[model samples]
Target: MNTTTVITHQPVAPAPVVVKITERDWSTSLCGCFDDMASCMYGMACAPCFACKVSSKAGENCCAPCCVPGAMIAIRMKVRTRLHIRGSLCSDCIIDSCCGPCSACQLSREIDNSCNGHLM
Candidate 1:
């Protein structure tokens, strides 16, 4: 008689956390500033001022809060006439390479959220 053996594999670790931002947070990050100009043609700069405040409290440069390495992912969810920011509890490197004005869509999304979805 003959017998066979099998082995199973396991995940190395849990997924990283994703960072979420509100319309308020969007105004703080530097990316937001750029996006705001692009989206609104410099008309809605005051929209995301709250985010700038939170970023200031956190000692963040510009309006965006610095994300922990491999700890968070940014997501954009539509809310009413404006777009809001929401962080996920996991990280995803969806856009590792692109090499444009914004390399990754994730980064662009974060910037958009920071700018209150003003940029296209």
Candidate 2:
């Protein structure tokens, strides 16, 4: 007669660890064109030089077209959202130094850079 023994073994491979990237809320304000507006609003005074304007009756902010050729209209507005990357790591700092027309564009560039071009 022969005796047999049974043994149990654990799995050879270990589970992989998943790292989740945290998102943080960030906000920025800029001034530019409103995208859609009738000419009757501003009339002759509407030079499109300063897109940012205050509605005389509504008391709200408004935007207009740009005066310079090839230069898009720039308006002032607030941009708020959650970013996947941290502020310090953003590339806006680099772009701001190189080519930035306004503080808002510079900040957006920095955010885009920090997010590795993933900023929306």
Candidate 3:
């Protein structure tokens, strides 16, 4: 007598993981420039250079601030939008215009914070 054996297999796929992050405030306030002394000093010492550095860190052309008109406000807006931080273009314009260095420092801190996992 001969016996036959049958084997069956089932493949299970895991559900795709989904993560959602809500909009929130900036890691550091605009006037909270002193929170990061290094960036604050850098921005104070050389505003343009600081803006360029921040632009680069923000994944924008390093020369954007130097070459583009209103690049400071644009960079600020970009950072705000990319990070989903709560703000408005009018606010960005006012901040970037009146507080250029502070804005740059704020953007730098925000980028650093987000990169360091403060994004949650």
Candidate 4:
């Protein structure tokens, strides 16, 4: 009598699971300009310098925001995406272009509130 046996083998263990990187909601709102008085004053006093400082705190090129036309928009987008804010790049650009000081102030306030005035 002859018996036939089938052997089943499993392939290498399933590849390690890939985790999706998800960001969290923003700490503050885009239009919350008056939330921080000091930031507002700094931004209002000197838009370029204020923007540069905000950009620096956000881990970006310190001089880009002042030298580049759309740099403020980029910085806003970065913070938005990093903080998981729901907004469009076009809107950010418009805000950056139309109200440079306000945008910088808001962004500065956001970073400060989120990080407690510490680099993240």
Q: What is the lDDT of candidate 1?
A: 0.34
TM-score of each prediction:
0.19, 0.23, 0.77, 0.75
lDDT of 2 at 108: 35
* lDDT by residue for model 1 (1-120), tens: 899866587648988999855444433342343543443332234323433333332234333423433211221222111344333222123321121122222344454454553433
Q: Which sections of candidate 3 miss by over 4 Å? A: 1-21, 116-120
Alpha-carbon RMSD, candidate 4: 5.2
lDDT tens digits by residue: candidate 3, 1-120: 999977687768999999887889998888887788988999999999988888888888889998998998987888788888998999999988888889988988998888662222
Better of 1 and 3 by lDDT: 3
What does candidate 2's lDDT look like per residue over 1-120, in tens digits?
A: 999977788657977989987755333322221221232234324433223322111122333223332222121121222444234423444432343344334233334444443333
- The 10 consecutive residues of candidate 2 with the worst lDDT sum are 70-79
Per-candidate Cα lDDT values, in order, are 0.34, 0.33, 0.85, 0.80
Give the per-residue lDDT of model 4 (tens digit) for 1-120: 999988798568877989886766556555676577778788888888888899899888899976887888988898888777777999888887888888888788878877675346
| lDDT at position 119, candidate 3 | 24
Task: Tell me how candidate 4 scores on lDDT.
Answer: 0.80
Best by TM-score: 3
- Go through the candidates in order and give the C-alpha RMSD of each one to the true structure: 14.4, 14.8, 6.2, 5.2
Q: Which numbered prediction scores highest in lDDT against the true structure? A: 3
Candidate order, TM-score descending = 3, 4, 2, 1
Q: Please list all clashing residue pairs in model 3, or write none if there are none.
A: none
Per-residue error at 57 for model 3, in Å? 0.2
Scanning candidate 4 in windows of ten residues, the lowest lDDT window is 25-34
